[model samples]
Target: MIDWARVGELVDEIGAEDFEEVVELFLLEVDGAISALEAAAGNAVIVEEQMHFLKGAALNLGFEALAQLCLKGEKAAASGRADVVGLDEVRQIYRSSRLQFERDLPDRLAA
Candidate 1:
């Protein structure tokens, strides 16, 4: 599960204005990379690149589970093992994490 406490602390440290900006940046990067990864299919280079970017972004956001998924994707892609089906699992996790983040953020701020 996502760590709401850490997220709350991060929001408190950054302030609402800065937090919004960072979230926007994160969304842009994640959206773009996910799209590219989907389009690339079996292309190892593209998959690895997208996963690498996602790994870094997730790490920076303190999203440990998402970051770990990205790390696995990166290793798989690096090995030239194109498991397109497995990518869907990663996508699902990403979507779930993102949705949870969005849903919890406002409540955290309100509190």
Candidate 2:
């Protein structure tokens, strides 16, 4: 669900001083995207584009579980199978991933 190593790499690459800002930006942007996704629901075009964006952002943040779901939805939408993609499930996974990431990041980073 979370990739601690990748998260550490990102923190190192971006520098600790700027990590919080990055986290804020991530949450802000991802929240907007998720809202758009909800509005679009199973719309193919929106799902394809939004899911692609979500997948990349999620992977960058080490939200592997969310990224995987986004990838699957993106592919399905791209293939004209948008109906099979569960937007609710995607949102649920993101919410869950975010919770876990928030809960564990401090300890994991300190360690």
Candidate 3:
């Protein structure tokens, strides 16, 4: 889920224009990471690396749920259980988070 407070703080610090740019860049980066993650398949090391990167990025943007998922996946992958990560679930969460973020962002920012 999106953290409106964190988003607000970020917007306050960077202004709307820059925040948008950051969000755009973040989405692009995450998309690439997700693609790589999918391609990693059952490679535990690759999954761990990608999940670690994703967790950090998600945390930075206050995508709390996604971050948690990434952390779980990271730990699992670290333990050589990449199959537990379940790419479908991760993709679903990301899509949901993205939809909610896009839907509520403008209103939240205006408020």
Candidate closest to the true structure, highest TM-score: 3
| Tens digit of per-residue lDDT, candidate 1, span 38-104 | 8987798888888899988887666768888888888888898656336777778788988888887
Looking at model 2, report the run of 10 residues with the lowest lDDT sum.
Answer: 82-91
Count of clashing residue pairs in every prediction: 0, 0, 0
Candidate 1 global CA lDDT score: 0.81
- Residue 79 in model 2: shift from native, Å? 0.8
lDDT of 1 at 66: 83
**All candidates in order of TM-score, best leading:** 3, 2, 1
Candidate 3: tens digits of C-alpha lDDT, residues 1-111: 887788888888998999889999989988998999989978999999999998988887778888999999999999989988788988999999999998988788778
My TM-score estimates for the predictions, one after another, are 0.83, 0.94, 0.95
lDDT of each: 0.81, 0.88, 0.89
Question: lDDT at 61 for candidate 3?
Answer: 79
Task: Name model 3 segments beyond 4 Å from true.
Answer: none
Rank by lDDT, highest first: 3, 2, 1
Q: Give the true-structure RMSD of model 3.
A: 0.9
Worst 10 residues of 3 by lDDT: 1-10
Q: Is candidate 1 or candidate 2 better by lDDT?
A: 2
| lDDT minimum window of 10 residues, candidate 1 | 81-90
Alpha carbon deviation, residue 96, candidate 3 (Å): 0.4
